[model samples]
Target: MSTATHTATRMATSTAGHALGDSLTMLRRNLKHALRYPSLTFAVVVTPVMMLLLFNYAYGSTLGAGIGGGHYIDYVTPGIVLMAATSGALVTAIGICTDMTEGIVNRFRTMAISRSAFLAGHVVGSVIQTMIGLVLVVGTALAMGFRPNAGPVEWLAAAGLLLFLTIALTWISAGIGLVAKTVESASNMPMPLQFLPFIGSAIVPTDSMPTALRWFAEYQPFTPMIETLRGLLLGTGIGTSAWIALAWCTALTLVGYFWSRSVFYRR
Candidate 1:
């Protein structure tokens, strides 16, 4: 290669390396914080588990009868899994907001690190934390008689879908955090996302709702996602829900990513 070309290649490689290293450093920092103060994680995990129990016991008998009377826990487990991830993602917003407010981000800005690494760290670390919460929730569901017909391939697909959903939501949470003026506001911003499952097919059939509410529950992003997970794990037909869920995830991720970048650079 020509000298100039080789020099450019080396420079690009070095920049990529630095970016990766910086991102890893930030990820470690976030994970350490999660380990040190695990109450938040426990809180996130507990909400979904409690919901699972509440629905399975208080409402499961009545609700299960509506959907054939025996597999309500199976039907609701997918929704609770998503709920767990959503609950964990709320912490990403709070953590990001706290970091932004404490001037630590300003210090990072002064360093010769990747500009996106700070946010990327939170996103990656949050995904991992969310996955752990998902596992715990799923385990609890199984112990409570939630059974799935999924084989290895189907189980892997369910895992991939969950990870994609987590990443998409984490990005949105990060963006919300960036836009908020305070940590409290950031924590509150993603609250609506957690409740979305209730209005959708997560806990009950959307078809049973009133016309307008049913229409919304049928068309909303979470419905398709919950359907897709149900299809994967319980051998239900995915139909168009998989495509719709993918579209929602991709669109939300792109919007959240760009919005966060814009807000971050502006500040």
Candidate 2:
């Protein structure tokens, strides 16, 4: 190889190594914070469990009868899992906002570390935390008599979809955090995302909603995602919902990734 080519290769390798090491360091920092303050994680886990109980006991029988005599728990579990992931993502926003306001970001900027590493760390760590919350919600659902006939492939697909959604939203939450003036605003900004499931196919069929709400619930991202997950886990017909869900997730992930990068660099 030419000397110029060798030099270029060495530069690329060094940059990649630095990025990896910096990201791992930031990941450990975020993980330590999560461990030190356990209440936030506990709150994220508990909210979905509470929702599961409320829906299953209070509204399950009535709603189950309307949905063709199948157990409501089976129908709603997927949505609740998504909800749990969404709830956990809120913490990413708050954490990022806290870092921004506390001057930590400025210190990082002065260092020679990779600029993107901190955000990457938060995104990866948040996804892992969300998965834990999702497992807890799924376990609770199973104890509440939710059952699925999904084979290994189907289960794997469902897990992939959940992880994709978590990453997409966590990126958006990180952007939201960067723009907020304070941690309180950062926390409040993600409130609408958490409530989206309630308006979609999470608790009841979109058709049962009013005509206007039906239109929204049908077209919104959450419904298609929940439908796709239901199809995978319960063997329901996915039809076009799978494509629509994938499109939404991909579009959102790209948009959030770019938006966060732009905002972070501008600050």
Candidate 3:
């Protein structure tokens, strides 16, 4: 390559490294904040854990039988887990909004750090927090007799899928945070995402829903993810649902990323 081209490549490489390094620094800051003030993380874990117990103990028998006389807890574990992931996404929105309100982004702007690192840090940190919460949720489910037939490879695949879903939701939540004028509004904006599993195949099979609801349940973003996860965990057939779930994850990630970038820069 020419000297000018070589120099340009080196600059790009250095910039990318700085962005990654700065993002990790921000991640540590958020993680430390979560550790010191764990109320929000506890709150995020509580809802899904409560739902799992209520459904598995209070209504698992009926719902389990309704889903074809199998263990309801097994069928619903992935949905609840995904719900936990979505709940964690709320942290990103609130955290981003809090930082913006505190004028932290302005402070970040004055520093010589990468511009994208601000939001990227929140997204990465939130995904890590969410994944940790998911491990707790899964442990709870397992304790409650939510046995899955997934082998090591299957478990790995399921974790991979869950991570991708978490990333997508976190980005979307970050965007919502950027758009919200206040912390309260940011918290409320991501509510639909957290509860979307109910409208999908979370509690029961989509086949059991009424015609219109069933149609939507089959096509919505969450269903495919739930189904794919369920299949992997239960040793059932995944068919093409894995591809569909990835497609949704990709589209959602892109949308959230660009939206967040545009909104953050506009401010």
Candidate 4:
């Protein structure tokens, strides 16, 4: 390679190395913040657990533990994990938005920090926290009679998919948090996103819905994610949902990354 080309390559590597280190440090700090504020962290984790218990108790009979055999609880556990991740990312957005509004973000901007690292760190941190919450929820579900037919490897894949969904949505939420003008707007951004699953396979099978709604229920992103997740967890074939889920995750992550970058530049 030419000297100039080699120099450029080295510069790029140096920048990436520095950025990764900064992201890791920021992530550790945020993780510590979560640990210090146990109540807030506990609240985020508990909401989904409460939701699962409520749904199983109140609507368990009506829903009837779903088609694949075990209690609907087993079938629905993946959806519960998605819901928990969604809920957790919503709070993630609000917290980031608050930091931006209160000048914490600006303070970091002035420091010798990688711009992307700031958000990437939080996104990584949220994924870690979401996984912890998932473990707690799964423990509760096991107690409530949910069992996984899939072996450890498949179970890990199921959890991995849930983590992918969490990371993808957390980035989107972070973008919303970064761009939203007020705390209320940032907080509400995830509400509509959270509601998407209600129309998908999360609560009921798409085939069970009316024709029109079923069409929507079948194609929505959350349906595919949930379907793919169910497939992994239950050792069932969810067909196209697996591919579609990956597509949706990729698309959302790209949109959020680019849009949030633009928002940061504008600010």
lDDT of 3: 0.92
- Alpha carbon lDDT at 247, candidate 4: 93
**Model 1, span 201-255: residue lDDT tens:** 9988888899999999998889999999999999988999999999999998898
**TM-score preference between candidates 2 and 4, better one:** 2
RMSD of 4: 2.1
Total clashing pairs for each candidate: 0, 0, 0, 1
Give the alpha-carbon lDDT of every model: 0.91, 0.92, 0.92, 0.81
TM-score of every candidate: 0.98, 0.98, 0.96, 0.91
lDDT, candidate 4, residue 212?
A: 97
Question: Over 4 Å off in model 4, which ranges?
Answer: 1-9, 65-70
Compared with the true structure, what per-residue lDDT tens digits does model 3 show for residues 1-267? 999999999999999999999988998999899999888788788999999999999998889888788788899899999999899878999999999998988888999998888887888889888999999999999999988988999999999999999999998999999889999999999999999999999999899999999999999999999999999999777789999999999999999888999999999
Tens-digit per-residue lDDT, 16-105, candidate 4: 999999999999988898888766467667877887898788887678645544477876777877777777767678778888899988
Clashing pairs in 2: none
- For model 2, the stretches where C-alpha displacement exceeds 4 angstroms are none
lDDT of 1 at 161: 89
